[model samples]
Target: MSDIARELNLNPSEELDLLTKWLGRESTEHVRRIRSVHVANPALGLQLVWERLEESYGSPEVIERALFVRLENFPKFSNKDPQKLRELGDLLTELNSAKSEGYLPGLSYLDTTRGVNPIVEKLPYSLQEKWLAKGSQYKEQHYVSFPPFAYFTDFICGEARRRNDPSFSLTPTPSKTSIQYPKYEQPERAMRNVKRHISTHKTDVDVNRWTSQSDCSSFKPDDIGKQCPIHQKPHPLKKCRGFRSKPLEERKAFLKENGICFKCCSSTTHLAKNCKVALKCSECDSEDHVAALHPGPPPWGTENKNSPSQYGGEGEGPGSAVTSRCTEVCSRGQSFRSCSKICLVKVYPKAHPDRATNVYILLDDQSNRSLARSEFFDLFQIKGSHSPYTLRTCAGVTETSGRRATGFIAESLDGKMNVMLPTLIECNHMPDNRSEIPTPEVAQHHGHLKSIAHMIPCLDPDAQILVLLGRDVLQVHKVREQRNGPHSAPYAQRLDLGWVVVGNVCLGSAHKPTTVATYRTSVLENGRPSLLTPCPNQLQVKERFSSKIQNATSLRSVRHDSSVFDDCNLGNTIFQSTKDDDQISSSTAPKQSGTSTQ
Candidate 1:
């Protein structure tokens, strides 16, 4: 023991040194015997070691060393003898008060089978505070399991109390007084008493064991299946013979054969009112006799009633059709009649001006030459005229006519010309009329001189000026020349007029030279010309002529004539002669002649 103690650095005289030497022996049987003896008298064994340590190393150092060894081996010995925990607590308290070389090592003991309790409660309040503070620091340094250490500490303090108290013992106590047994009744009473005692002891042992055992190992028997203690039967209610005798399906079939609900089996093909099994529908007041109750509103009566096609039916009241029609009328506008004659006679005639005949003119401003005539009548109006004139046709239809007697005015500062086509302008003027006619108002509004002036700037500024007057305005600005005298009005006054003739006009076959008689006639009344005579000589001839000039040579000449003859002859010769002249002329002439001489 001394040599082993020397090797382990334990004092030779110390009790722990001797115990360590004994514990290190190779014989397992001897070691087991020592453990058993320690278990049987753990308090006595602890006291013997403490006494030996005091004799060898003095009380203070021995107590300190004992505390370290006890804590070190605590895990090994704690379960072997429960009283060992009380012995350890006592030693720790003594070591904590004794003088030591350094701070006492923090001691932690874990009892794996126990739960947490207040063992520190048995400690002196000051030592408790000291250890608790030390415990906090120790917990920071060590990774000990919680609750186990706490339970062990509680058990140690409790056992310490038991050890200190004289009345406390591990052994059972006997009753202080006993009742005498009757000699004749002893055996039976003994048997009864034995039974009673057995039961009482069993209950006491259970309670005592329960108090000592931790929550981890505490026994619980109630987790088993239900039992009837009186009859010793398992699942008593479910096993009842009456409930198993008839199947639910059989009951349902039997009741239904009799035209009754399975639940109550009353008449009316439904369960009786008193039946507990009957289910009531939440949606409607009707009960569900065969199926579970459905949850929403009744399907039949809940459709929207305001739909159009549905308004004449079962739930509809009287006068619904009239009310619906009135609603439609309020939403839509009122209707009116649509007829063609109403539009033509009343609407169009009221809105548009009366139709008048159209006239065109041809002019050549470079030679100061121009031809002027009314297409249907010989009457003419010239340019620069303030007043308009009238023309009459051979059919005795008299129409008030004028030049394209209006000038266009530019609305913008830039003087942009809106040279609208005749058809477009006419349509605009008579929006309600079907026939095409150029009214005076339309011509005046559309033909502005400013628009014409703007067009002059587009031509070469250095180029010589030319003026062309339409036949409707030709007489007013005509150049009259003497036939055989020098003192004649200059054919045309030379002026810097910025105007040009850009396009031609097409006169129809009905066109003829105008005459005074033709000018005064009204076709609506007479339906024919009053004068139907044709010219016999060149001076008196009045014939329709092409207005075009051929090449620049004829273009320089102001006036040139072809031939004028009577219109009496009507044959292929007349048609041939007309075609020959049309081919010879460098102009798009008017079409065939429709007039006759009578």
Candidate 2:
């Protein structure tokens, strides 16, 4: 019982109580008294409960013991009536002997049973004709033969219901003798409209080829023993008919949902980055990713490059209508691009203040609560309490247990203001909104203002976004002023932390436009994140001291390299290794190289 409880994540005492309550209601009076008199092992108690039920109701018959009866008075048989005496003895012997079998038939009451089978076989001549015609019609329409004998009764019953035959009824009215009979229902109307999927294995294209056999041992692929994630069938995911049939984006989402490695197309414990199996894509012969997850144009032929259809002119195809509809939606302030404001910041752990780590943070005012990656906690040496966290996003709801860290400090690149960050929830993975870094070149396109272009920091393309600051950190979100631009132009907004450009901004013809679309994510926690800020007195004193000792200190002892403090430096820091028996730790940090980052 203890082992069982541990396996099921339950308490042993609770398991005992549940079994007791269940058995107490269904057991006999003697068994109930025995249960009340003494405590028994839960396993034994459960067995006794099931055994009692089996004895009473498991078998089909009610009585198993034979019975005997005697007459009160009878006439005496003499020598002259030997035949009559012999007949009386035989009757008495048969009555006194043990019974051969019970009155019940003990047969399964399925379509093969006596009740429905005889009725289906001996249907009226008109009904039989209709049933035969139905079978023949199905064979002709589907280009297949009639169903197997096992399903014959079902086919006849279905035809009978369709014709509304009074003699052959599925749900007959209940009579006194048939009170416990099961009421059957006809197949739903939707089932009739379902399209049949014929087997494509044996086709004219490959009929002459040798049959594919599972028992063949001569040829085995890399995914021979693996099962497909999409169809849940025993086949390679890339070779699955269902997987190859879906569009590219859905295939990516399918891999994420099933936790299959995109590089190898196999479900393994290690991530794609750590995957040792090397597979070359057949499409482009690229070893970076599997052919199934190729990011290039789809295998299906695209429009001709020289044709007007390629440029999406009027009346090109049905796609033009969809494109125009999307344009209208975009004109109405709806965004279809994935973008957000991501900036680098230094995070100081409470336990290790001197070892501040550089981390990229996404400033999102729409999120009610901030979130950090679980890796951030280990890297910063921050300890937190475990708690159940519920995250709701545009996609769906995700419930998982996470840790809450309340001790942390966030600082800007220029080191102007220092603020204590609010409580942040740890998540296994962040939202999918990877966009091109907002560089200074992107800010130069707008003619409204370019005076503070130098102040607009350039985000490195290789920086890994580790944290998201929500509105809960109220101090950083206070908008001081804004430089507005013309319609559909990106504008710079000044916050307490620094200046940030927002909206779609085109850099050049070679570079794509930057998309700053908002992805709203709400985090539900037991305790709300309280806004925390550093004391004004402390900041004033620190600022004054720094001004007085500007040139006094010559030899500075810097723990990290000078490039780490630069605005464009996105290299990950190699921290000291910490060995723990329970948790796995890594000294190096992750880089944004491919799809393996998430």
Best-fitting candidate, scored by TM-score: 2
Predictions: Cα RMSD each: 53.8, 35.2
Question: What ranges in model 2 sit over 4 Å off?
Answer: 1-339, 383-385, 432-436, 507-598
Write candidate 2's Cα lDDT for 351-402 as tens digits: 6555565677778888899998887888766676778978776535678878
lDDT of each: 0.30, 0.51
* Ten-residue stretch with the least lDDT total in model 1: 339-348
Query: Please, what is the TM-score per model?
Result: 0.15, 0.30
Name model 1 segments beyond 4 Å from true: 1-69, 76-82, 97-159, 163-598
Q: List model 1 lDDT by residue over 337-417, tens digit each.
A: 110100001001111212111222113222222222222121112244223333323344343433442222111112231
lDDT of 1 at 303: 29
Could you tally the backbone clashes for each prediction?
18, 0
